[model samples]
Target: MKIAVDAMGGDFAPQAIVEGVIMAASSLPADTQLVLVGRQDIIKELFQKHGFESSAVEIVHADDVIEMSEHPTKALSQKPNSSIGVGFKLLKEKAVDIFCSAGNTGAMHVGALFSIRAIEGIIRPAIAGFVPQVNGKHAIMLDIGANADCKPDVLSQFGEIGSLFARHTLHIDHPRVALMNIGEEEQKGSVIAQAAYQLLKENKRIQFVGNIEGKDLFTDKADVIVTDGFTGNILFKLGESLYGILKERGIEDEFIARTNYESIGGSPIIGVNGNVMIAHGISSPLAIKNMISWARQQVEANAYIHIAQALA
Candidate 1:
């Protein structure tokens, strides 16, 4: 399987991204093709510096780079040769099975939507990531940063999609699903959330576990949490901050090293027609390597196909 890496999108740019690509090319399965998408000259220099051949990691020349502040729609239209645009175009053409980037998150989302397009039944493509809870259990959070305003139907779809991901990817049977809310009562929060909660509670596809407050995030109360992108992103960042503080306290050496930003690598964007993994801007070589492995596993498991069928 071929995975395209955006070598110039992140804050660290070509340097860290190139190192990660080299590491993946060397350590990953021999058949896995690593397509490094970025400014060709700089990427080649990094490869040469590391004593790796250009053949080891294929270069997909992209003339422009999208700034983090640039709007996705604007970048896609104005900067056709940008890394985000070129990399996404490659995915659309089936040049690669997966597209990975540490670039502007908004640009990535917008580009993927137009490039790979969303599945037929999907209302909005959700950006999802697994948050580790107590006893190594994970809770899948959806709409982490995709769509902000969502209708009740959108939230219900998020729960359904998130549940499928937990079952197929994480091997969870009857994964408990919860709507992030202000209270445990059914009438709590905005009308949209309340209505969504009602539908989720009555839905048969997922094991709807009722409302989950922000405090319950790490309590092992739910395996999959669904919310609109606005709330989901807030909770995601909050969780990250909490984890950061925990690390700063120097709690557990093992968990600290394992759960750090550099270690976690990337988050997979679900609901799209293909695989697109988005990494942290500050991701290290190890994290990039992990992202490649994660993307390969998703392809091997046929996660996107399984999800497409499940959503259908």
Candidate 2:
């Protein structure tokens, strides 16, 4: 398997990203290779500084870089030679199994939709976040900062796609799907949520598990939690804040530690044609290393093909 990473995507750029790639190189399997897309001269210099040499890691030259503040669509069109653009180019050509970046979240999202395109019959593709559970496992949540506002049908599709992701990625045969809302009752949320509940119950692909509130996020109430991006993003960030807040107070909790962004590294953009992981903009070497680990698992799962087959 081949994994392509954007070397110039993060806030720390080439230095931190290169260090992370070098850290991951030591444990890579013989069959897998890590491709770093960026300026070859700088990447090579970093490798020399660390005295690292390995056949498992290769550098692919990319001329330009899309800055975080740039418009996603415009930057992509104007800078096709950017790291993110080049990474997607490799993916589109089947040169790599997955593409990952921490630089520009919007660019990553837009690039996936424009390059490989969405699965057939998909209402709207949603971004899936890995929700760490208190029971020492993780649940999949959809629409995490992808689509801020979702219609009833769009939210219902999140349940279906999210279920497939959980089953294929988490190895759950019959994953439980739940809609996130204010209350646990069927008619608790807005008009859209009430309508979404009925649609989710009627879907034969998933095992509908009624509703889940914010309090049940870490309790593993369901294997797949469905919510619009607006709510899901807020909850996801709130969960992420636990690490720093507790670290400042010198609180060490294993479960809360799992909430740290570095633990999982990246979140896959579901409903796309190929695997794409979006990491935190402030990702450190540890976070990048962890992201590569999850990228391996995602490539192995090959969830996108199964999703397309199911949709067909």
Candidate 3:
């Protein structure tokens, strides 16, 4: 399998990204290759400065870069030679099994939709985030900043998408799917949630558990949580802030440590035709390395294929 890394995407471009690729190259399977997409000269210099020589690593030159503040659609169309743009091209051509970036989240989302497109029968693609569980396992949450406002049917499809993701990536058998709501009752939440509950309840693709409250996020009550992007994005950021606060207080614990974004690496843009992982903008070398591993795992699990089958 070949995984493409956007060497220019993150805040710590080229340097941290190159370091992470080197780290991943050392441990990755001999047959697996790491393709770095960015300026060829700079990448080679970093590789040499780091005293790394591996045939499994390749570099694809992309002269331009999409700035963090640039408009997603405009940057993609105007700068066809940008690292993110080139990476998507490679993905579309099947040159890489997975494409990952820690740069602009919006750009990545836009690129995925425009380049690879969504799976057939999928109303909208959802971004899946990992929620740390108390039992040392992880639960999957969907629609995390992908579609801020979704219809009831779209939310229900998020359940199926999240369920398939958990089953394939988390290796869960018959993963319990739950809708995030204010109360545990089916009739709770807004009109959309109430309507989504009925659709999810009748859907046989997933094991639909009733509603799951915010407090139940880290519990074993649900293996997959579905919610609108607006709510899920807020919750996702809150979790990140909580981790930062705990670390600032010098509090150390295994469960809290699991809350680190580095540990989770990145979130996958599921329901898309090809594999695309989007990491945090401030991702460190360790985070990038973990993202590569997560991407490889998804490919090995045949995640997209299973998701297509489930949606079908």
Candidate 4:
């Protein structure tokens, strides 16, 4: 299978990104092809330094680099030669099975929609992030930052998709899905959330477990937590900040280590036409390697197909 890499999108740029691809190529099967998309000259030099076989790794030149600070829409429209643009092009053309990047996420999302597009039944695609719970369980949170305002139908879609991820990826049999809200009662939270809660509770396909508050996130009370992109994004940032604060305080080292971004590697954008993995911008080589492997795993498992079937 061919997996495309955006070599210039991350903070460390070509160096760390190339190193991560080399690591993945070395450990993966001999036939696994890694197409590194970025500046040709810099990628070649990095490959020589790492002593990777030229045949196994190929560099596709992209002239421009999309800066994190730039506006995503403007950048995407103007920078056709950007790494993000090239990678998405390859994905759209079926030249690659998966596209993985540590770039500006908004740009990535916009570019993906423009290029490869979303799945047939999906409305706007959702970003599914992993939340590590106590007792070695992990919960899936949807629309983590994709769409801020969601209607009742959109939120219901998140519940279905999130539950599918828990069952398929986390191997949770009959995963318990919950809507994130101010209180656990059905009448609590905004009108949108309350209406979503009612639909989820009545849906036969999912095992809806009522509303789940923020405090119940890490306690393994639910396997799949559904929230609109706005609330979900806030919780995600807050959780990351909490981990940073705990690490700085030098307390809960063991717990903090488990919940770190580097450890999680990356998040998979669900309901997209093709597989796409988005790692943290500050991701190290090890984290990038893990992201590549996870992307490959998702492709081999036909993650999109299963998700669609489960949702249907």
Candidate 5:
């Protein structure tokens, strides 16, 4: 399997990306190849400087770059030869099994929607993030910064999508799906949450576990938390801030360390036609390495195939 990386996309471009690629290349399976999409000259220089001459690694030239500040749709349309654009093209053409970047989040989202589009029955593709549990395990949360305003039916679909993802990617069977609400009761939360609860309860595809309040986020009460993107994004950022605070205080706990974004690498944009991983813009070498490794695992698991079957 071939996984493409946008070498030009992050705060630390080709240098950190190339270093991460080198680290990932050394550990990746012999059959797997890493494709770095960016300026060939710079990539070559980095590879030489790092003394990395792996046959499993290849460089694909992309002269342009989509800046994080640019508009998503505009950048994609204007910069066809950009690294992010080339990565999407490779994914669309089936040249690579997965494509990943730490570039503009909006651009990645727009690219996935326009290039491969959503799955046949999916209302809207959701972006998922990991929530670390107290028991050293992690829970999956959906619509984190995507589809901020979801209808009742869309929120319900997030349950099914999150369930399939938990089972296939995280290897959790019979995943417990829960709606994020103000309280654990059915009537709790806004009108949208109440309506979503009923739809999720009636759906037979997932194990609907009733409402999960904000306090129950890190507990084992739910394996997959479903919420509109606006709330989920807030919760995700809050968790990040807490981790930052802990680090600054020099507190080192195993579970707290898991909250670090670098440890999780990145979150995958599920429900797309192909696999796409999005790392943080400030991702380090370790973070990028883990992201590529996780992409490899997703490809091997045939995550999209299982998702399609579950939706069907």
Candidate 6:
């Protein structure tokens, strides 16, 4: 399998990405290849700086770069040779099994939508975040930041896709799906939440477990947690912040260690046509290395194909 990574799309740019690629290349399977998309000269220089050379790693030249502050659509359209642009191009052409970036979040999201596109019958593709559970496993949370405002039907679709992702990718049989809300009761949240609850309950394809409150997020209450992007994004970030907050106080916990962003490295944008991972813009070399590992899992699972089949 080949995984394409945007080399010039992050805060640290070529340095961190190249170093991370080197770190991952050392441990990758012999059959797997890492494709670095960026300026060839700079990428090679960085590799030489680290005194590293590997046949497992290849560089794909990209003449331009989309700044973090640039508009996603505009940058992608104007800069076809940009790292993000070339990465998506390779994905669309099936040259790589996966494309990942720790650069602009909006650009990554847009690039996926405009490239291989969403799966058939998908209302809107959602970004799924891996939430660390108390049981030493992770729960899949949908619309983590993709669709901030979701209708009842859209929210219901999140449950269905989230369940499929959990089953195939996480290897959970009959995953229990739950809606993230203010209360555990049926009538607890806003009008949209109440409506979404009924829709999710009526859906037989998923094992809907009703609503779960914020307190139950990491308690292993459900295998899949459904929430609008607005709420889900806030909750996901708040959960991720535990590691930094606790570390500053000289506190170390086994479960808290999993909260570190570098552990998982990146979050996959589910319901898309192909594998696409979005890592934190502030991702470290460790995070990129881990991201590449997780990307392999995603490619092997091929959840998007299963999701498209299920929808059909």
> Can you write out model 4's per-residue Cα lDDT over 131-250, one digit (the tens) per residue?
877677678888899899999988888888777766777678899998999997889989898899888988888999998898998888888888889999888877767677887887
| TM-score against truth, every candidate | 0.93, 0.99, 0.98, 0.92, 0.97, 0.99
lDDT of 3 by residue, 113-166 (tens): 889889999999988899888899888889899899999999999998888888
Please list the C-alpha lDDT of all candidates, in the order they appear: 0.84, 0.94, 0.91, 0.84, 0.90, 0.94
Clashing pairs in 2: 9-103
lDDT of 6 by residue, 1-312 (tens): 999999997888879989999999999999899999999999999998999999999999999999999999998899888999999999999999999999999999999999989998999999999999988999999989989999999999999999999999999999999999989889989999999999999999999999999899999999999999999999999999999999999999989999998999899999899999999998889999999999999999999999999999
Model 5, position 66: C-alpha lDDT score:
96
Candidate 6 clash total?
0
lDDT of 5 by residue, 1-312 (tens): 999999998999878888999999989888899999999999999999988898999999999999989999999999989999999999999999999999999999999988988999999898899889999888989989978899999999999988988898889989999999999889898999999999999999999999998899888789999999999999998886777899899999888888888788888888888898888899889989988988887888767778888777
What lDDT score goes with residue 70 in model 1? 88
Residue clash pairs of candidate 6: none
- In candidate 2, which residue ranges exceed 4 Å CA deviation? none
For candidate 3, the lDDT comes to 0.91
Error of 4 at 118 (Å): 1.5
Show the lowest summed lDDT stretch of 10 residues, model 5. 302-311
**Predicted candidate 1 versus true structure: per-residue lDDT over 1-312, tens digit per residue:** 898999997888889888888887877777888899989999888888998874557899999999978888988899999999999999999889989999999999999898889888898888887676756666789988888898998899888888877787777888899999999999999989999998898888888989989888777898889989999888877666655787678666543344455555778888888889889887778878888887887666656777788767
Give me candidate 5's TM-score against the actual structure: 0.97
Give the candidates in order of lDDT, highest first. 6, 2, 3, 5, 4, 1
Lowest lDDT sum, 10 consecutive residues, model 3, at: 302-311
Candidate 3 similarity to native, TM-score: 0.98
Segments of candidate 5 deviating more than 4 angstroms = none
For candidate 4, give the lDDT of residue 4: 91
